[model samples]
Target: MNILFYNDSQDQLFHISPRQRRVALAVALIMAFLTLAALFFAGTKLPVMSAFFPVLGAWGVMGDVLTSFILFNQFRSSRIFPLLLLACTFLLTGILSLFYLLSLTGMLPLSGLFASGSQTAVWLWCFWHSCFPLGILLFMGSLHFNKKIIDRRLLPRYLFSGTTAVLLIGVLLLALATAGQDKLPVLIEDGNYRRLIETAVGPAIWALCALASVCSVFPYKKRGVLRVWLSVAVFAFLLGVTLSLAAGERYTLGWYGARIDSLIASTVVLLSIISEVNKLFVRLRRQHEELEESQQALESANEQLKELSGIDSLTRIANRRKFDEVLKQELNAPQRAKEHLSLLMIDIDFFKAYNDHYGHLGGDMVLRSVAPRLEAEALAHFGFTARYGGEEFAIILPGHSELEAEQIAELMLESVRSLAIPHQYSDVSDQITISIGGCTLRPGEKSNAHDFIGRADEALYRAKHEGRARFVFANSARDSCLHPFETTSH
Candidate 1:
């Protein structure tokens, strides 16, 4: 039923849920038992059961019409050729069934329309059964045609106009051909005549049925629920035809069995459609959850990338860019205007000589060893440390005066000396040491990151000039530079 709505081009059978699979198995087993029982007792007929034939026929008509509506709606949404054909087939079958049912009940306005129990009704009956199979054959044959031939924008118009024309033509021909011909020779009177008619019409219906079965197989070659059920539908159709032939008389037990077979065959596709719909909803929900999870994972990865961008790759600390950004933010921040902030400039003394003697690789190890100590001391003092450039690092301490900044710098100096990294090429003690320059100020509207950094750099130069292993303070007053006792240490 949903074969027309199928979007997958891979020629595989449609999937179904476990629950649907179980339902299909139950339906198949019941249908199989019904077919066997009907065949086993072909001659026996209960008048009560036979009386309900009309009711069952009415139900079959309604089912086909409803199924047609569903298929047509699907056709409108998907614009698939197979869906359109199936919808039309069901609709036409429903109409034909109505005509046949009206004749059986003697309610048709056209009394000449193959009047009940008449010879012409036999021919019409055979023709009615053949109509749906022919439509199925047409659908199967056209599957290989170019899809572009049916323009979607004009499809509804074509369908309406084309079906109208065909219906009108068929009605006109049926009326004209059968007019005044109700009294024709008996179609089933003589055994030879019956055999002749059967031989002539039987092959045509069987050939169409065979072709339809072939078509069903072509679409779903892969093993799956849809393929299994579709094959069952086609087999049921063939079995119904067989039962009709074996009945050998109208209104017999075999005839009722044939009708039951037709009903089951027609409904198999509809049952599959319902099952497939449930599975589709389940799959869509799973896919939606997966999509949401993937989006969240992507957001998390992007945040990690953003953080990495602001960090130095070698030392895994805040880089120069991060330091510059923070310095600008601190200088302009209104909340910190009256609050003391200090910048410390620390340089590894004789780093170039150290790199040359120990090689750049060993110098990189010494730099990595020294950075964590500096970062820990700055962080403990409620500050952030960054690698300002090669051989130099800067710490930004908010709410820290010059005296408090000096203490933080002392801790960092001690932390580096504690490492006691050997430096054979140093002019100072044969271990790594850093010169510290400390600058403290209360930021104002006029304060800039460049000037703040320049004062610290100048202090650092002063510290290096005096001796390479001591701390100096750059006074904010333009005329004054202070040395914190110049406690030089190695």
Candidate 2:
């Protein structure tokens, strides 16, 4: 069933543990402590770094864009409005950071992609920093109103509006930084920003950040992994902004430390998303392997069922059904165009008389003993044996001539006589004996399987009337016959 919220098992953020919350808290405190140490050395000047601003700005741009993409993807699935707002903030941060890098004076050969002038980088940085926490505040506030599932039809509109708003804000900031620079307060001057900058604008941005943190903690009582990490990230950015504002000069320890904090803040959520994706992929691969094993086992069971259907339950060999199928197959086999095949019909003498004297149980025992002995002799001739009916058995011999069939029939008779099962009611002898009748014929266009079996039965009747222990023969192979379809290959 579809729930009110889009539940994703892969999204660890949806199910935060107490340990994770503690770890997140510890991380926030550590960054806070480190930033305070950097602030203590705020005015200490260091060697100038020509590539630091551009490289760090570029790194922040890539990280922010990736984080925005991950959050946006989640928003698309869940249709959660706050997630879209949060994603837009990241995208805005990335776009503005790029502009900030390009506007810097003599930092790199790359410049003028958007607005490049005095204080243009500073104003753009302010907008980027201030707008992000404002976005966070809105996100935390909106979570309260999102008790129902979002309508999927509104998804495209929400996505387009959120992204467009970020771009429009970026364009407005560019205008203020470039065209209306004279109207704005000076945030950066003489390659340093100390009392005037820190006292007015820095504290205001800090207050905005502090309010955003309060919204996350109080209104949103149910904490998720993403929200906790976002709070930690916002806290880090707050300290980084404080560090940058306190630094009296461009090449101070505070300036570099602030950039380090920015780097950590930008990559934290993105790394978590990557780890979540890796875990899901491993689980999917394991499920696929298990499904394949189940399918293989099912196929094996089906094959065994088919084999069982053709088997005789009583004799543990081919029954009448299997014998009929094999007889039909042997008749149609293409090798019959060159060679002959034989069929044998076997019957024990005085079987019913034996049953009347010793009871049906004793007759059943005699039949069971006689079947395997015939099968053993038939196997030597590359033939198969089946229980045809009561006290009667049949054997099929492929690629056997009339003379070879006759020889095998004699061996089958001898094999049964050797059993010496006592049959006191027998008219022939005290010992159990069997009668054999067989036929050998090559396949032809005119060959009839029923006629072949009838001829063998006729021979068996003659053997029964003429003394039971002997073998009788029917029609042998007629070489001069109609050619089979296999004789002419297309």
Q: What is the TM-score of each candidate against the true structure?
A: 0.51, 0.58
- Model 1 poorest ten-residue lDDT run: 476-485
- What is the C-alpha lDDT profile of model 1 across 1-490, one tens digit per residue? 3353235442123654566556656766776677677877764543545456578778777877777777777666656676577678777777676666665566655544533444444455555577777776665555556343356798879679646754664464345325533544344653122442455566667566767766666644343554456556766776677666666566667677888877776677677767667778999999999999989996896577447658887787889988987788777777676788899999999999998888999989987998988998887887888998998999999888877787777777777887989988877667898988888885453567888899999999988897777678897333222232345432
Candidate 2 deviant stretches above 4 angstroms: 1-12, 105-115, 195-199, 218-221, 293-490
After TM-score superposition, what is the CA distance of residue 5 in candidate 2 from its true location, in Å? 4.3
The residue-by-residue lDDT of candidate 2 on 132-204, one tens digit each, is 7888877766666654446999888888998998999888888788777778888777766564365577778
lDDT of 1: 0.70
Residue 152, model 1: Cα distance from true site in angstroms: 2.8
Clashing pairs in 2: none
**Candidate 1: TM-score?**
0.51
Cα shift from native, residue 210, model 1 (Å): 3.6
The Cα error of candidate 1 at residue 423, in Å, is 50
Worst 10 residues of 2 by lDDT: 479-488
